[model samples]
Target: MSSIKWPKKRLKRIVRCKYGDSLSKENREKGDVNVYGSNGVVGSHNKSISFGKTIIIGRKGSSGSVHFSENSCFPIDTTFFVDKTTTKADIKYLFYLLGLLELDKMNSDSAVPGLNREHAYSKEVLSPSYTEQKIIAKYLDKTCASIDTIISIKQKQLELLEALKKSIIHKAVTQGLEDSVEMKDSGVEWLGKIPRHWKAVKLKRISKIQSGLTLGKQYSGNLVKRSYLRVANVQDGYLDLQDVSTISLPKKTAAGLELKKGDVLMTEGGDLDKLGRGFLWEGQIEKCLHQNHIFAIRPIKSKLMAAFLTLITTSSYGRIYFEATGKKTTNLASTNASKIKAFPIPLPSKKEQGEIVDFLNKKTTQIEKLKKNIIKQIETLELYRKSIVHECVTGKRRITDNDLKE
Candidate 1:
C-alpha cells in the first residue's frame, strides 16, 4: 500500500533457525535467563540459547506461535529459533508475519505433531522495503502496547469481580441478610462468626449421603443401559450434562442409585481445589445415576435447601474444609462418604435459606452478565490486534505518519 512492491522471498533466504536440546521443565535449575518453548518462555536458566534478536517458533506442541525477544534466549528442542543476523527482514515484522500464517495448525508430522523445518523453509513471505517495514512495525508496537494496557486493566477488574463475588457469598451465608442479628462463634475456626439464629450442624445430621455403583462388564441383573454422571458432570454450583454417556446397570441397582429432582450432586475427589465442587441436579434425565467418583446428598431435614447447599459447598468455607480434611496426595485430593457427612454447615430457617438463594441467584446472574460483556470486549480487542497485524504485514494496510499519529 505504501508503493513498495512487496517481493516474494523463500523463507530459507530471509530466515535462519535451529533446534535446541531436550531440557525438560523438571530437570532445569531455576535462574535468570528465560527458556523459550514453542509458544513462549517456559522457564528461566543461567545459560541462554542465543544472544540478541531471536524469534522462537513452536516445532512440536503448541506449534507455530511466533515469539520475539530482543535479548538472548534459550528455545528448547520443541521450538526453532531464527537468527536475526542471517535475514535482511525486520525481526518484529517477521514475527507479525509468522502469526498471520497460523503455522501451529500446519503440523506436518502426524504421529508426534511436529513442524517440518523443510516445510517451514519452503514457504514464501512477502517482504516490504526496510524503511516502510520499520514504519509499520513501530506503529504496531505503539498501538498494541496501548491495547495491552487496556486488556491488563480489564483482566484485573475481572479478577476483582470474582473476589467480590466470593466475599458477597461468604457474608450472605455466614453473617445473614439482617446485619442487626446477634453473632456467635461457629466453633469451626474458618467459620469465625455466624448469626445467632443459625446452628452449625454436621452434614450427616441434616442430609443422607449416597455414592453410585461403578460400572463394569461382569455385572448382571436386568441390566439396562442408562445415563450416569461422573466427576466431569458436576462443576462448581452447576451441572454440565451436555455430553452424558450411558452404562449398563441392573435396573434395581440403577433405581436405587437414581437421582431425584432436588438431589445435590458433588465431586468426590480431584485436584485439591476441585474437592467439594458440586451443584443441584434438576432431573436432567429420567433414569440417570452418578458414578462412584460423585456423591449425591439428599436433604433429610427441612432446614437444608438444594440451591443453598450448593452455594455453601462452593463457597470459601467448603474449600477450606476440603483442603484441611480431605485425603490429599500431592495436588490431588478426595473425600469419602464419611468425610463428606462430617462436613459442618450453618443451618438457617427454611424461609431465610430460600430468600438467600433467590438473592444470590439474582446478584450472581448480574455479575456473570457483566463478566461476559468484559470477556467479549477482550475478545474483540484481540481480534482487532490480529487484524492490524495481518493488514500491515500482508500489505493490505499502508502505514504513514498520519496513521502513526492516530
Candidate 2:
C-alpha cells in the first residue's frame, strides 16, 4: 500500500519535547555524562537530566538540528529533548522523522532566532503501526552507517592530499633543489640548515616594508580616490580583485602607497595558521592601494627576487616563524612592522630563486587538481545520504522483511 494511505497524526500526539535545564560552565562538574547544547555534545558532566535513549532538538543557535544519545545526558537550556517516557513512538523512528522535517528551516523571527515548539507540534505526518516503525528505523540504521563509512574514507584522502602539498613546498623552500649541495646550519631552530652558499639575513636589509594607507582619516582638502586592497582581497598565492573598494587620500600619499608590480603583500594577523598570509602583487588593478593591516614588501632588485620571496613567506617555514613570534590572544595572532622587518630570510642566489619558484608552481597545480576532484565526490555522497533518509522516514520507500535479509 502507498504511504499516502497511512493514518495522519500531529507530531504532538506521538511525542512531547520538554525544555532542557540551564547548566552554566561555572556549575558544571566534569565526569562521564554528556552535556548537550543546540548542536550536540558540548562537554561532559557528573549528572544527567534524562535517562535511557533520548532525542535532543535544538531550540536556539543551531535551531531545528537533532541529536541522539544512547544513554542518559544533560541537555542545556539552548535545547529541548524527548525520551522513551515522553513519546509513544519508536525512539529511532522519531529521530529519522525529525531529520526529514529539516527543523533548522522553521526558525522564528526573533532577534535571536529560535524554534517554536508550537509550530513543530502542529506539523502533521503519516502514522504507521508500531511494528512497521521499528522495521523502517532498522533499515535506515544499517544503510546510513554503510554510507557514512564511505564518506569517512573520502575525507581521509583529502587530508592526505593537503599534507602532501605542504610537505613538497616545505622541502623546496628550506633546502635547495640540488641534492648534492653542501649544507650549513641556518642557526634558527625552526629553519634547521640551508645550502652552504646561502646567507641568513634580516628582511630589512634586502626589502623596504611599506605600510599601507590607514582608513577613516579626515583629509583637509580635495583628496584623490583610488581602489585599495583589503586583507580579504589577498590569499596565500593569489588575489581576489573582483570586489575591490575605493578610498580617498591625499594625492601624494596615494601615489606613494600605489602597489607596484612584483611587490609582495602580507596580512598582519588572523587565525594562527593565517598569520602573515600573503601573495605577490602582479599589478592586477590600476593605481590600486592596500589597507593599513596589510604590509607591502618591495624587494631590492639586486638582492631578492619577488617570486622567491613570496614562495618562502607562504611556505611552512614562514608559518612557523610568524606563529612563534606573533603576539597571540586566545583566538588570533598578529605582528607589527618592526617584527616583519626583522624576519630572517634564507638568502639564495638570484638565479636559483627563480628556478625554485617555477618548480613549486608546477607541482602545486597538480596537487590542487586532485584535491578538487575528491571534494566533488564527497559533496555528491552527502546529498545521496540526505535523500535516502528522507525517502525511508516518509515511507516513499517501503521496507519489507525480505529486503532486510539481503
Candidate 3:
C-alpha cells in the first residue's frame, strides 16, 4: 500500500481570510441560509453574505472557534470568514488545520478577547496535495462522526443512570423497601401509594421557614455585611460554594438568618428547573447567611432530619408539586414563602427517615462514581477525537487508506 506524501506550508500561503460583515438581528429576515457564528450556526437568515464553501474563525467573543459551512451562508461580524476570493487550499482541510493550530489560545484582545487575523495567518501549517487533503478530510469526517455518535450515546447513558438513581431515591423514600407490606393511597395522586404507617404533613407544621437577608435594601436597624449563600450556591440536592460572596444585612437579620448545622437550604425560585432546588446545610461555613432569594429551613430536630427533607424535595413527586404551584412566566418560576411552607412531606418514623437518608447517601454516591467514570470515558474519547483531527491535519500521523479498515 502506498502512503501519501505531504508538504509543510504557512497558512497564509495556502488560503486567504477576512472578518465577516456586520448584520443586525433586527434587520435580518428569516430565510434558508445558515447564519454562521464563531462556534457554529447561530440561526438562519434570508440573505447570503458569503458564497460557496466557507470557514468561519472567531474574531471576537468566542475567539478562535472555527466552523465550516458547505453552502453559501452569512457569517456575522463576530467572526472572520476564510475569503472565497483568494482561496487556494481545501476549505475542509483548513478547518481541521485550524483545529490543530489551537487558534483559541491566540487571543489578542485583553478586554473583550479577540483573534488577530494577521497573527492567525502567520502560523505555519502542513499543506497536503489536493488529493491527499481530500483523503485526510474524508477519513476525519467519517471517523469523528463515529466518535461523536459514541459520545452522544455515552451521554445518554449518563442521563439514564442519573434518572435511575433519582428513581431509586424516590422509591426508597416514599414507598420503602418492603413493597409487599400494606400500602395506602397518599391522597397526593403524584405520590401514589406510600407506607400505611406514614403520615403526610405540611412543612410549616414541622419546620420554621425563614427568608434570608435582602441585599441592596435599607434597613431600620443598624446593619453590617456578612457572607451569604446566593441562588447559585445551592444546587439540586447539594451546595457548590466555589464562588461565595457577601451581602449586607441588619445585624439582627444576619443573626436570625444564620445557617444551623441541620438547616436545609432551598432557593426561593428562578428558572423552572431551579424552582425547588436545594440541599441540607450541614454547617458548611461559620456565620453564613443566605440571600433573600434563598430560604433556610430550621426543621424541628425531634420531627425530621435535614438530609431526608432535601431528598424528598428533590424527588419527582415534590418536583411535580412545586412546578405546578410556582408562579411561572415564560422562563422563570418562583415558589413563594407560603407555598414552600405548605409543601407536603411524607412523615415516617425518625428512625425510618435516618435509614432512608443513609441508604440514599450510599446509593447516590455509588451512582455518582459510576457517572463520573462514564464522563471520564467521554472526556478521554473527546480528547482522543481532537488529537486525531490535529494529527491528521498537521501531518503528525500519516494518512493511509488502510486506516479506514481499523
Residue 297, model 3, lDDT: 86
lDDT of 2 by residue, 44-96 (tens): 89999996889999999999999999999999999999998899889998998
lDDT of 2 at 60: 91
Where does candidate 1 clash, by residue pair?
Answer: 63-104
Q: Pick the candidate with the highest TM-score.
A: 1
Q: What is residue 123's positional error in candidate 2, in angstroms?
A: 3.7
Residue-level lDDT tens digits of model 3 in 1-406: 1224556666778877776878777878979988887778888889887778888888888899888888889999999887466476777777887877878888988899998878878987666778778788888988998999999999999999989998998898788767687988888756788899998888999999878777777666576877888888887656788999987667876888888888877787778876775677878889998888888888998998888888888888778888888999877888888988888788898999988888898999999999999999999999999999877876777767687666
Q: TM per model?
A: 0.91, 0.88, 0.85
- Number of clashing residue pairs, candidate 2: 0
Which stretches of model 1 miss by more than 4 angstroms?
109-113, 116-119, 235-238, 402-406
Clashes of each: 1, 0, 0
Model 1, 19-102: lDDT tens digits are 866788777877887888876988887778675777888888877778888888788998888756656778787777777776
Q: Model 1, 38: alpha-carbon shift in Å?
A: 4.1
The 10 consecutive residues of candidate 3 with the worst lDDT sum are 1-10
What does the lDDT read for residue 8 in candidate 1? 85
Error of 1 at 377 (Å): 1.3
